[model samples]
Target: MLSTEDLALLEAIRETGSLSRAVAHLGKAPSTVSYAARQLEERFDALLFDRRRYRLQLTPAGELLVNEAARLMQDVARLTQRVRQVANGWESRLWIVTDELLEFETLIPVIDEFDALQSGVPLRITQEVLIGVWEALREGRADLVIGATNEPPAIANLRWMQLGEMQWVFAVSPRHPLAKAKGPITRAMVAQHRAIVVADSSRVTEGSTYGVAGGQTVLAVPSMRAKILAQCNALGVGWLPRHRVGLATRLVEGTDRFI
Candidate 1:
């Protein structure tokens, strides 16, 4: 409940150690400082100043008030700053959802840059596959979405821009039959093998799948990383992000036969 003026008056008196000196430090009349000092003692019903000593000093109770007041002042300052930040349209927290096709590691540098702003907004990152990315935003579960694949569905107040294009490669384990298949493998040939796919995480939507041939068996995994591992272990074969295929999985040549 202590006011800023009260704290300033106490600090000036404690620092200067005398009535006249305190008045000079506070840029106030000597009479005014003397009256404020007496008022403070009466308000607290305690002798806050030790005038018995030649060099005026604060009593133990006064010292405690000043120390605690400093901490309260800091809390007030932080609260005021947060209020202004909110008034200026800064979000209290941000939730970002990205498709599993985009590696989470790729966002580390961007996160570091956002941290430099010191906006005091907490960030949460999550991943979904295929339509689940857009579903997160539409369902009020995400503040922003990244690497969402396919055209965005209709959602009120939605804003979007194309981030970039992603290239895909039909990949399989070196040990798989497709690894040595003849040029221009047919959809019928792929249908003979199981396809590894990342399961969509949408709760309300029917969800979607990609790169699976008709009547092909499927190994639906939770993430793209799992699909890649499945292909590497010769568990199945399917299209993967071109950048993620790497040397562990062999890219099927002549994929132009059936995109």
Candidate 2:
């Protein structure tokens, strides 16, 4: 129930060493500070200050209130700033969907910078694969999309910027037949092996996949990690991000398809 003025009185008295000095520091009359302090103490039925002390001294209850008041003031300040930012037309919240193929570690640094700005906009992030990234924006589930691949589906008012081209490496387990093939593997040869693919996360669109050869059998998984596991286990063969699976003889180079 103590007001900011009462808390400021405690703080000023603590810092300035006496009631008269606190009044001078606060630019208030000595009587005003004294009367407010007395009213606060009477309301709480606790002595806030040891008035007999030569210098300003707080009773245990006064110290507790001061400590708590400091924290409360910080919360109040942050809330006030957020309210002002919202009133100034800043976004209250933003949602983003990133493609599973994008390296999440690279995004962390940007997120750290955004947090430092304290823009009063809450950011929520989620992962989608391929076309699902675009669908999230179209469906109004997200305000931003990162690492969208292919020409985004023809939706009106969709604006995009290319972050950079993502390179995919065709890979398979050491045991897979493609790993043993010496010459350039054609689309027909690739079709003979089962392709491991991460399923798109779209709810509204039909969703899409890339790099799978015509008529290739597929082992669909939920995430990029799952696709890697399937290839390592010889469950399927498909392209994966080069950084994730690493360079190996089982991985074919020069198959860099830009996405």
Best by lDDT: 1
Once fitted onto the true fold, the runs of candidate 2 whose alpha carbons sit more than 4 angstroms away are 10-21, 42-52, 115-120, 153-157, 243-259
Predictions: Cα RMSD each: 7.2, 5.0
lDDT of 1 by residue, 1-259 (tens): 5777787876666566676787899898878888988888889999888888777778998888767766776667767777788899988789999988888778999999998997767799998888888989988899999999878999998899999999998887877998888898888999999999999888877688889978899989987767877787889999987777663433333232221
TM-score of each candidate structure, all chains considered together: 0.69, 0.76
Candidate 1: residue 77 lDDT (0-100): 70
Per-residue accuracy of model 2 over 58-144 as CA lDDT, tens digit each: 899988877787777777777788889989987768898988877678799999999999786789999888777888888888888
The reply for model 1, stretches above 4 Å from the true place, is: 1-78, 247-259
